[model samples]
Target chain A: MAATTLRSVTTYDLKLAAPLALGFLVFFVTPLVILLALSFQADPQGSRYGLTQYVHFLADRFSLGVLGSTLWLGVKVTALTLLLGYPVAWLHQRAPGWGKGVIMLLVLLPLLTSVVVRTFAWVVILGRQGIINAALGGLGLIDAPLKLLYTDSGVVMALAQVQMPLMVLPLITALSRIDPNLADASSVLGAGHWRTFRKVTLPLSLPGIIAGCLLTYAAAITAFITQSLIGGGQMLFMPMYIYQQASTLQNWPFAAAISIIFLAAVLVVVSVFTVLGRLSRGYTNA
Target chain B: MLLTRRNLMQTALTLGAMHAFPGLTWAQARPLVFATFTGSWEEAHKAVLVPAFRKATGNADMVLDPMLSVDQIAKVTAAKNNPPIDVMLHDPGPALQAVAQGLVEPYPVEKSAYYKDLIPAAQEPTGPAPFFQVVGLTYNPETVKTPPTSWADLWKPEFKGRVGITNLNSTLGTGFMVELAKMHGGSESNIDPAFKAIEALRPSLAAVAANPGQLATLFQQGQIDISPGNFNAIQILKARGVPVEFVAPKEGAIAFKTTIHIVKNSPNKELAFKLIEAALSPEVQATLMEEPYLIVPTNTKVAMKGEIAKALAKDHAEIASKFVFQDWAKINEQRAAWIERFNREIRV
Candidate 1:
């Protein structure tokens, strides 16, 4: 009787998920399958199906360079966000109950606006005669405006700011889950603040760190608007590269092949993060 | 009425189906969807063309679904039998692509009252050109004291770190490159000189804008003093008090025929014809040629005035003499290669 009830409950739970499961199958999985098939076609006309598109992308040095730069850009943005986002998360944890709301609102403010609007603001801020240049110019610190916009570092900075909430929100959740007594226990045992953080707090927040990094990394790389607007035309990241090929050139086979390769590369990166997250979970519990 | 589970389920399912596919409720007689270009084009059409179209068809149910030419082609190609859009607007490149793909219906020349009245260049059998998108040199009047007279001024040492150009992804960018090639003894078939010229202009380039739209922003920010800009786009900026000026170079301003087409297999073919007819009519074209819109009218009967006449050509004969139209068919053949080379070579 117990076994039957248990089986019925499990089946009922799954049945409840039927609509969403069907939605995924019809909308998400089906298109992905079609995209996969489209990637194998030899030409835009799809007269012959073969490995030609993949070969073209893999053989070309420029294509590979674009892929590498995109991945590297994700890495830079993730690292920057983590470095910057950690303190805010820590502050939120330590903030007196009422103070937490203000910090949270400030962090969430950027996310409230459209990414296009945020990116254009960055464009204005980074331009030759922008606020930063004007400030620097007024101070008589420089003869000319710094070439801040349309460069690699500029893109990374803009993306980090744009994707900050993705990193911070996950981190806040993780940090809140951690007990405060652990830090106190470390301090009473004669560990310094830095040492306590490294040994106790850091290890405990590993899950949050990993989750935040994964979310931020994914968003930063796929941020087509921010990437193009900040990086400009000459930068040529993977998203823009795909857009140019697919939309402008109308070479769908090559575009699809590139997209598949990008997906695979992203999967590899994400898997590595997941493995770290799994290990961190084990470490935290132990 | 006692609500049984069976009847409740039946009602819910029916409602869900209706919500999911509104077409199921509306049946086959949907509005005529015309996919015009986004931004200023959409604004112009919404203000002028749509009203004209409505007046012609006695308040026909129509919609202006604005998007890029490439997007328009993609949507039509995706659903060839029952296309979502009835009409499409295109630049020179995508216009040829649409014709080659057999996505455009040949204009009913015998039926079109205004087709014969259009300038010779605007009269296309597959899709007639309703407007001309002119590309010329745009600069900030405050910074650049002397008005640039030729394309060569962009390459001058005086403009170092003050020039802007887009990559070959846009019609404006590709047309600019072809014109550069021509300046250096190359033509539509060969683009080598253009690459060499860009390489020479590398030092002067302040920003390689991702699109023509970005160039306007760069100008507002003072990131670039000058760029190869569209006439209509610059006019929009100037109206916004951006302190920018447009000039037709001695080499000639690059003109792209902005063609409108009837999508093949359209359900509302009759309405689509009426819309195109309204677009080509002198009255509609003349209104579009006025201030703010400043759209270059291709109808010979629509006398040029205001910004269009002052900035572009004064009359039809002057337009013929001044405007340099390229062989887009030839350009389209090697466009992919040019874009690839551009992606590889041009980096700021």
Candidate 2:
């Protein structure tokens, strides 16, 4: 009799969950499913419904080049941010009293401001008559101004500035979590401070590095407005291409196809990172 | 150097290749939807057309949809099998693209009535489709002290960083250039010098806007003291007592007569056609002109000798003498290639 009551309760729970699952299918699952279906479609006026649209986007030489550059920048941004962000994170970790407050403010400033506002600031700094050139010219430092605004270097610089907050926060968390005794143990055993840090602290902090790199790379690849305003006609990224296809051209299938391609690319990157981390023997409980 | 006044149509001319979704037929009673854009078009749609359309139809429920040009295109194309919009106020190129691709059906406008009321250049002597009304350079007189009397005045170094112009691919920008070319030893016949001169004036161009409104806002702010503009913003400025004017400079900004067409597979084809008829009617067109004189209707009976029209055509006599409208259909075919090359080579 008690077992029967338990079975009835289990059935009641699933009955309630059925509607929620259906709702999920209706709202979230439907659009994604439709997009997947349409990604394959191609018609004369637009995509009708086939693998043709995806094939068309993939087949283009221009799109392939854009894909290559986009993927490269994603990796570059991730690596560069880790290099810059790790030091700031360490400073924040080792900071004392008043130093901690200042470091916290510095880290959070970029997060508090709007992305568009921050990007516009970069524009003024990077433009032809902007601050850097003015200072250089005023000092009689150079004859000609540097072409800094629209180049690939400009893209990376702005991207790094925007993504520093993401990289630093995770790393700081990881570094602070390290046990003080592990360092003392190495020193007690007559290991020098540098050796102890190299053998212990550095290896321990890498998981945070991986996590920060993952977040930064994902954010950088998806950045649209910053690249759009600065790049203009000069540089073309994946998001911009998707915007043009979806908005300017009104090719839904093409946009969907490109988005699917981008999603696949990201998954592969994430999978590779996971594999590499596993190979490094990250079998730690903490 | 195909010296046309606009970009080549990037929209592919692939017609009737797929069957579209016919959601709700016009035979059924559903309110017709008109896709309106932001700024002048939005104001006109809201204040003028919607009310008139509702009163005329007596439904009091005419639907107005707001989307950017590209978004609207996406919506229309996304719902290609089943279209939501019946009527559109789209640019000529997209309209032409739609017509060629069979997204829109031929709107049986009386060729004689449309052509007779319009400047000759707007007639589609060659292309499969002709859509979009032509708009040109309108400016504010209070701000433009020794105002631009011709296209040539815009190139002066005095207005450097004080002048606003649209991107080259836009109809008005293309029109402005064609006018300059005609005056500076290029013509509908020869356009090389015009390209050369435009390249020279790139240094003087303060900003390149996507449309005239951005240009107008900059002009109003004193960031830009002069602009090569369209008819709508000048009228809005004059309404607000901003001392704006529209010049016909000897090379008149190219004028193309516009049209409204039905999408072939639209579920709302019947209501769409009726709504279009109302949009193009004497009442609605006149209403649009009342606040911000956006369009001088193709209807000859509108009798546009009003205070607004006179104020808008600031230097009418001078512009009338020199105005030369380009043949748009012929130019539309070659515009994309020329614009691409100009952007690539001459934007130094």
Candidate 3:
């Protein structure tokens, strides 16, 4: 019993993580608790404490619409990133050793540049007389420029590009971990490339897909700079909405309430992904 | 001399404590931090104002911590007892907000050497306006053959899909809305006409930029031909070889007074007053009004010249006649509701 109870070499003492835990408590948890308390105030002046701010947000159609649209934007961006990122991940996995390095560098290239720079590049690309419109106009495809810069499609496209690295890297890790012999074995049993991919390769990469989607989804929603820059002022997301309330209006209680609501909404989505990840783990093991 | 482990530990802790709590060292006073706006404002102040301030104060140690007006208010409000900023710069809207929040000290009018030399509009007991930000019609000279003379020209069919404006989160945006409302028979309390005017401008709108800064980029990209833009911002863009020109609309140029104040509980209050005094000086104001900066001066003694005289107004009397200063106190009262309404309504 003593032999069995002896500490294993692989296990670390809980005391080793005490400093980090203490830091998290002081910085992160303490601030969050304060924010939660602040949100209960009825007014910016904190004259009364109640659920007025929450009610004010939840009851308002405009506020709910902003929240809905922000969440929907995340869904659209995550979907686009996954759709575009999956092929690159697959290609990376299938590449030769040197080709793998080249593909990795290309995948990681966007991450090196700042998000603001990337967003601005998107602005230049999506403008009325921008590269796309210029190319189209030169080819005599259209007489007038298409409105792309401030549109929903413009925001989705930009966000997808900015967050592409998050989706692709995780996918590459998952795809590389799959056994090369399994695909060969599936083919030997008379399955086609698409069939083998759907059955064997696809299921194996589900965990990575879930993780990538989670990261991209969360990032695309809270990305204040990219959302504001590419999405334009007219397009109000949760981040901008919070900023408007907090900074512009100085309604701290309302801003805090909105942020807490946004946080709760994000957590709900993350939990759904977490459950899927657990199921994917079981499926991959089986 | 032995360098014992116990002695080494004591030395390390002493150093750490001194680093953490800097007040333990009583020999040094903290640098007098002046929170100014970023970009060209910082550049202009660093080049002209800082040098002038140092010269006046016998080479006093000061730092220019550039940030937005709201951020300055927040930092000062967070530590009211011991404010980090000795001085703060604010637009008309935030200047009132700061005063209401009791974040700033009232200007010592009796003590100031140059306060009486300023224009009547520049004199405020809370904080004195050292500079004016003029908002006028900014258009691409290359694209716009005939320069826009009125704000109403934005709604004209000829400018279809060639105009840009910002949402009402910025001073420029809010001021523009107030101007529009006034043009359409509405006052500061009544913003309904402005919303109606903006509705009419929907057909002509190309991009509603996130901020005034984005408007410059939009002009560069040829995404927008015309918009109501700040004079200084337009000058900066034009200096960078962008085909943009500033013109005072026939109605009037919107003037926003950028006020400077000492933080309420500032330890460097004396130095802060000295710096503000330097800002209000004709020498500093005149230099700032010159090329590259193009910042409008509030000091009547400065005598507006060069680009400011050419583009904005000829003299202080002309400035009074041509520039329309809005009631920011009234605007600030219902700005929150207006912002909410704009969020709900404005979309192109």
Which candidate number would show the highest TM-score if scored against the true structure? Answer: 3
Let me know the DockQ for model 2. 0.13
Q: How much lDDT does each candidate structure score? A: 0.94, 0.65, 0.94
The DockQ-derived docking category for candidate 3 is high
Distance from true position, residue B50, model 3, in Å? 0.7
lDDT of 2 by residue, B219-285 (tens): 5444456777666556677678765677655445555444455666765665665666566566666
* Ranked candidates (lDDT, high to low): 1, 3, 2
Model 3 bad stretches (over 4 Å): A1-6, B1-28
Instruction: Superpose all Cα atoms of candidate 3 onto the true structure and report the RMSD in Å to 1 decimal.
Output: 2.4
Specify the poorest-scoring 10-residue window by lDDT in model 3 chain B.
Answer: B22-31
RMSD of each: 3.2, 11.5, 2.4
- What i-RMS does each candidate reach, in Å? 0.6, 5.4, 0.9
Deviation in angstroms for B153 in model 1? 0.6
**Worst ten in a row by lDDT for model 2 chain B:** B10-19
Residue B273 displacement (Å), model 3:
0.7
